[model samples]
Target: MLRLESVYLRLKNGSEEVPILENINLDLEDNKFYALTGPNGGGKTSLAKVIMGIYKNDEGRIYLDGKDITDFSITERAKAGISYAFQNPPRFKGLKIKDLLKISADENSLRAILRSVGLCPQDYLDRECDSGLSGGEMKRIELASVLARPSRLVIYDEPEAGVDLWSFENLLQLIRNYHKRGNVTSVVITHHERVLSLADEIILLVDGKIADRGSRDKILPLIQEDARCCWKANCGGNNDEVECY
Candidate 1:
């Protein structure tokens, strides 16, 4: 299980302090998928980064399986069964796809890893991680690496960002397969409704806070309504308070 208690991150904007995340509390049960959705600049990415230990929380604690990981470094968090995939994956100049997958899995061969992400071993295994690969190809390769890594909690930041429609569906099915095979906890950060529907639970973040948290059926309508009203529903004017998104 994963638990975040009153987690907060503060940063400087000009001279004033801005809250990237407010007093947030979340509990994620084991062997489930949670999808986080929100508008741009709503702090969804920041929260994901904080959970991965890329950014330290100014206040609050993070616990995985009841152990405090707030003081842990990024490597420590990875060692503790947390894996994160970035929205914009970095390019490795001379590394072949097979080499990257092998390193990610800490093993000899990565044929299964490549296959899991719908890549053909004979075709892509030797390709370099460079500009020669298209954007969708890079996204799939990064996803293959994420699947290769054996981690209890896997966080995918915009897995559907650059991929084509066919590949996107393939990726989604692969994630479902992963859930069935390993029963590993997964967190997906996406803006699309189709991606949101794939989650076991949907968390809507607004203004650096969890505005709504529930099953997809319960939250999707609210999100649509929120979008229609320009994020102001029932309430009269623009209020800073973050309600169910």
Candidate 2:
């Protein structure tokens, strides 16, 4: 289980302090799937970063399965069974795909991990995880690396980004399978309705705070209603100015 108590975060904009997350309190249960969704720039990703230890909270405590990890570094958090997949996965200039997988897990299991993400080890194992790889390829490789590790909490920031339709569908199924195994707690930050529908619970964040949270059956209809309003004619004053809910 993961718990956040009265968490707050602020950012420095020039000389002024701007609040990014405000009074966040949450308890994420083990072996559950959560979808965190809201409009862009709503601090959804910032909250994930704080949980992953990429960013520190200015106030309050974070506990993972009874241990206080509020002051833990990113490396410490990873060792504590927290894994995060970035929105834009970094490209390693000198690292081979197989080498990264090997570092993530044993060499004997590398091929299976690659194949799980729809990559052929014989073709990609020798290639460097550099600019030569497509965005979707890099994303899959990053996800595969995460899968190689044993994690109690897995957070994926926009996993569907930069992938083709077919790849996106496959990725969704992969995630579903992983979640069904009940080995880790999953948090997916996504705006897609398909992804949102898969969650056991949906958290709606707005203006740096949780606006609402409930089971998918309870929250999805509200989101769908909002989307429907935005798609109607003259919803945004004119068709040329259509707004996404």
Candidate 3:
């Protein structure tokens, strides 16, 4: 289980302290899938980073299975069974795909891990993990690495971004399979309705605060209603832009 108690974060914006997250509290149980969604710049990603120790929280505490990890560094957090998949996965210029997979899991498991993400091990194993690979390819490789490692908590940030519709569907199915296994707690930060619908619970963040949180059946309708209003017409009085509330 994971818990956050009165967590808060602030950033220096040209010498002024700006609050990014405010008085946040959450409890995530094991073997459950969660979706965190909100408008862009609402601090959803920031909160994820804070939990992973990419950014330190200014106040409150973070606990993973009853241990306080608020002051833990990024490496320390990973060692404690926390894994994060970035929205834009980084490219390792000289690393081979097979080599990276070997680092996460044994050689015997490499082929199966790649196959889980719908990639042919023979086709990609020798490719360089650099710009030569497409965005979708990189995304799949990153996700495969996450699956290779044994983690208690796994956070995926915008997993569908920049992928084709077919690849996106494949990714969704992979995540669904992972959730079904119930080996790790999953948190997916996404705006895709299909992904949101699969979650056991949905958390809506807005303006650095949780606007709503409940089961998928409870919160999805409200989000759909809000999306309809935003896209149907310029409800916010601007002719060119749709306001996502």
Candidate 4:
């Protein structure tokens, strides 16, 4: 349902321009789950931002449902049924959860949205979204706000970041359920093995370009091999020595 045509992006680091995404052309089908994963600085998040219109592409165009949206504003993209959940959810010191949901989505679906995130409406509806809440709570709150209105496509930038194990599992279930819905597309920017397993296709971005994209069998082994060398404490075959990052 989404397409990118010769997409290119570069950013200025002081005086030099560094390429973030180079000639990215992708076609994401409707109702499919695609995971974007790769090494640090591989431009996964940059590509997502370009799709969401958070960053303008240096060249080329982005189209959603056959319409060119390369120039759409972030708000305009949201209005057109696209949602992007940030890696670090923002805090609103004085905003209550109920008020945040009401402003972000259809007012009638507040309770349903909370429940969709596995939160009890009665317990969290009155709670403030401030430092008092835990990181997991904040993440879920942000997700709920983005999902307040029904979206044709949702891009989650590293949903597992900053969440505890318990919250991470819950987030996975939430995403799984969302993907089960018909005719909606999901793109997740993540490095977690569990998240990678959930994707219909795994896309490995390397050095600002797509290195490979295929089924789990074709891609997982490659990444696992790289992870074993880089992530393992002593680069040993022992399972206990592996430190997941």
Candidate 5:
């Protein structure tokens, strides 16, 4: 459903140019769930932004349903049936949840959107999106926005970040249900093992490139094996480990 051909992104800092993505070539089929996991600074999020048109590519092309969209604006991409949820959601001061929902799904459809996110319509509709809400609440609000848009391609950048255990599980179920509904392609960027297990394919990004990409059997074992060495007290692995999966 989506294709990225020889995509490249570079940031210009005075005379220096830092390449964030180098020659990225990927094809995403319709109605599939793709999970991208990698160490920090591996360009996973950068590639997501590139797909969403939040960052312009310095080389190559991006095509949505066979049409070149490499130079499309973010708003244009959204209009073209693409939705994105950021790692750190933005707070719109003085904006009530109902207003945002009405804007995305139309005033007549707000209740349905809230229900999709497991939220009570009446209780949340009048609430302002601000510091008063908990992290998990904000995450759910962002998710509701995505559901309201009903895009063909939804790129969630670490949807599990702020969510509590119960909410995280709920999010997983919601995503699974969305996938089963058909015609929607999802690209989830997460490092959680449980989340990765839900993917049809796990793409491991390393140093701005795809180092490993395959089914769970092909990739999970490698990470698990490597974790044997680098696991620490906080991450639940031994500190003296070497070549950990």
Candidate 6:
């Protein structure tokens, strides 16, 4: 389990301090799937970074399983059972896919983990993580690497980013199946409806604060309402990108 108390994070903007996260008090139970969704610039990724220790709070404490980890560095947090997958994962030109899985998996399990992410071990296990791979491929490989490694809390900042429509479904199923196994907590920062609908709870962040959080039935409608409002104000008669989140 993880808990954040009175968390406040602000970044410097010229001579002034701009608030990134304000009074973010949150509690996430173990073995549950949480979807963090909201409009752009609402501080969703910032909050996740704060939890992952990439960003330190101006005031507050971060606790994982009752231990205060506010002062923990990002590397310490990862060693403490927290894994974060970036929105745009970096390409390690010489690192093969299996090299990542070797952190905690054996040869046999490495194949299984690749298969779980819809990649053929024989085809991709030896392939380098370079510019040749598509965005979706790199995302899946990054996701699988994190999942294969033992971690109590996994924070994925926009797993759907740069993914094609076909790959998005697979990514959703990957998260769903992993959550079903229990024992590990999954927090996915996404704006996609299908991803939000799969969560045990939907957390809405607005203006750097917790606006609302509840079941899909309760929160999905509110998000849809925001889409409609966004359509009226910003869509410019084009229904393609709603800018809802």
What TM-score would every model get versus the actual structure?
0.87, 0.90, 0.89, 0.86, 0.87, 0.86
In model 1, what lDDT does residue 183 have? 49
Please report, as a residue range, the 10-residue window in candidate 4 with the lowest summed lDDT: 227-236
Deviating ranges (above 4 Å) for candidate 6: 13-16, 231-245
Q: What is the C-alpha lDDT of each candidate?
A: 0.86, 0.90, 0.90, 0.87, 0.84, 0.88
Worst 10 residues of 1 by lDDT: 231-240
Per-residue lDDT tens digits for candidate 6, residues 63-114, read 9999999999999899999999988888988988788678657867988898
- lDDT by residue for model 2 (83-167), tens: 9988889899999999888877888998899998999989999999999999999999999998788789999999999888888
- Can you write out model 3's per-residue Cα lDDT over 16-135, one digit (the tens) per residue? 999999999999999999999998878988999999999899999999999999889999999999999888889999999999889778999998999988899999999999999999
Error of 4 at 18 (Å): 2.1
Extract clashing residue pairs from model 2.
none
User: Highest TM-score: which candidate?
Assistant: 2
Candidate 4, residues 168-208, lDDT tens digits: the string is 88878878787787678999899899999989999999879
Q: Measure candidate 1: CA RMSD.
A: 4.1
Q: Which scores better on TM-score, 1 or 4?
A: 1
- Write the number of the candidate with greater lDDT, choosing between 4 and 6: 6
Clash count, predicted structure 1: 0
Q: lDDT of model 6 at residue 194?
A: 82
Alpha-carbon shift of residue 91 in model 3 (angstroms): 1.3
**Candidate 1's TM-score:** 0.87
Model 2 segments more than 4 A misplaced? 229-245
Misplaced by over 4 Å in model 3 are 231-245
